[model samples]
Target: LLEYLEKDSFTKDEILAIKTEDAGLTEHLEAIKQAYGFGYDSISELIEELEGYLKSLNERLDYYLNIDFDGRSVVGDDPDNLDDRDYGDNNVMPKNGSIHGTHVSGIIAAVRNNGLGSNGAANNVKIMAIRNTPNGDEYDKDVALGVYYAVDNGAKIINMSFGKSFSPHSDWVRDAIAYAAKKDVLIVAAAGNDSKNTDEGQYYPNDQIGVGEEVGDTFLKVGATTYDYGSGIISGFSNYGKSSVDVFAPGSRIYATVPDGKYRFLQGTSMASPLVAGIAALVLSQYPKLSAAELKQILMNSGLPVVKKVSLGDDAVVPFSELSKSGRLVNAYNALIMASKISR
Candidate 1:
């Protein structure tokens, strides 16, 4: 019953004939009409007869190759292919074709109950890959377009695991994010893995543009945490900011999916972002009726808080309480438990 927007396949009046026996149909369909009202929009089918519609998406949007969210971590790109394309290496390392994306993807959506390394947050979800980013600082244009692509293609939740300190057109990226908000897309971003206070050092594409609360309530920024809840719980590479970072999750020496049908250990906020992403995917998969804004709140309100005093990095050991908004780690079991409680 799922059908992505393929406007070209049918006339406007023909499209209007599609219907559902349930109650939310009118509201859902009307949202689609407004989102895809412009030309060049598309709608892709998801489970439960749900649909995904998109507008001007990024070129890398097609890189992810799945219809359902299955908890997959990817390195983000093909190192060998990228070299052929001749993109310089000033921003990132396209190592292992998608080691970053693959690992991050694994953290969130690696096949569950399959006796794998670890279970992803969302068990029955569809992953949509939009490969607009590479091993370096992504162009604002690509990030913006990629945001649009994910939102357009029916990604109710998006994980941005990469970021740079500088940008030339952050405004465009922010605007695209705003557009996703209007469409009710949840965007989860990485708190750069710089091991510094984000308040002292800022990262671009952040939700806070010195603007008031976002146009729509569908944005989250996450930090990284290690395995232990004791000292040094915050990954040595994680960046913390009370004003920016919303929460933290497993990101150090963590194992997950990688390119070329492989898996390995990796670190960074990249890993953390996907953990939240996977959780969001699970939330949406189980309860597709939840809005993007609600999903964002679900994460923040339900994260696993620890009372341990932790160290941030090599020489800075601070009380973990002041680190981020949630001051907690992501726990799938706990999250589901919370979601159930909130449902009432």
Candidate 2:
């Protein structure tokens, strides 16, 4: 769809003025215009947006075709070896042009109300950015070490916006998760973007140990929700699970800071996770004594439940209640209300 839109050089008004003979092309043009808010003033904006989407698609294709691709090879560390912790440097920023970590960081803490880019979900919070995830799939060893590093360095909240279909060292990461939990550091994770049920599949760095067991109480898995609140509210590409994803947050077309201090709208469960993390940070700012487990419970119990039926994927139309463990969307206002009550 985006590819077709990119090939056309016609302005928004030009496309709208033409009476297309083909019904399908007209429908596609209208949908694209609506989705992107393309107008006479924003034609170039639309083109830039399509370019980003195209670049992402190309990277994904490269990831699949290069089966031997190892992002960690440059660091000269054995990714399979759990004991290799001495690798990597203090340079947390991406060496390449990857702005994913920057975007996630901005979602959590972007110097609120500076008349800059966008206001983050939480105010008066310092961001501790950790760059463990590479441009491609992250190593399990890197993730485990990153968790430990964050928790040990006085970070009360850790947002992990990356996940993989496989985890060869699940135990290593699980142990790190437990270690953070013991230290009262809350860990927020993305539920992935596969558009599949996570309960039927497995994405690592999750708190779940088995079919029905959870290793830690402080971990929260977040799913993506569209800006629309009614039917078809869930994002089309968001992965969901009744027993796995803990809550939903605004992930569709979320505008946040990217590399080199630029802002753009990106969508994924990754964006959703940091939004929840920022809320958790707000709750903690007011109620300093609340434990990580207490914070997680407050977030889950205080969210707004969505009763409407929504799309799970292309074919399934399930009740919104069946999409997540809490059957609720994270509401920062409601969460703060509950947090104040708990603090009292």
> Which segments of model 2 are wrong by more than 4 Å?
1-31, 34-67, 70-73
Candidate 1, lDDT over the whole model: 0.69
Scored by CA lDDT, what does every candidate get? 0.69, 0.83
Model 2 C-alpha lDDT per residue in residues 237-289, reported as the tens digit of each score? 89898998999998887889998879987789999999999999988998998
Every candidate's CA RMSD: 21.6, 3.6
lDDT by residue for model 1 (1-344), tens? 13545444544455577766655766777766764552223443221112111211221244233234222124244332312223323333355446566677778778888876777777766777666665353667668777886888887888898887766677777888899899999999999867888777778677765423554567788888876668867877788887777888877656677677666566678888888888888776776777788777788878877787786556766777688877767776676776776653
Question: Quick one: how many clashes does candidate 1 have?
Answer: 42
Look at candidate 2 and tell me the lDDT of residue 62: 66
Q: Model 2: how far is 97 from its true place, Å?
A: 2.8
lDDT of 2 at 20: 64
Name the lDDT of candidate 2: 0.83
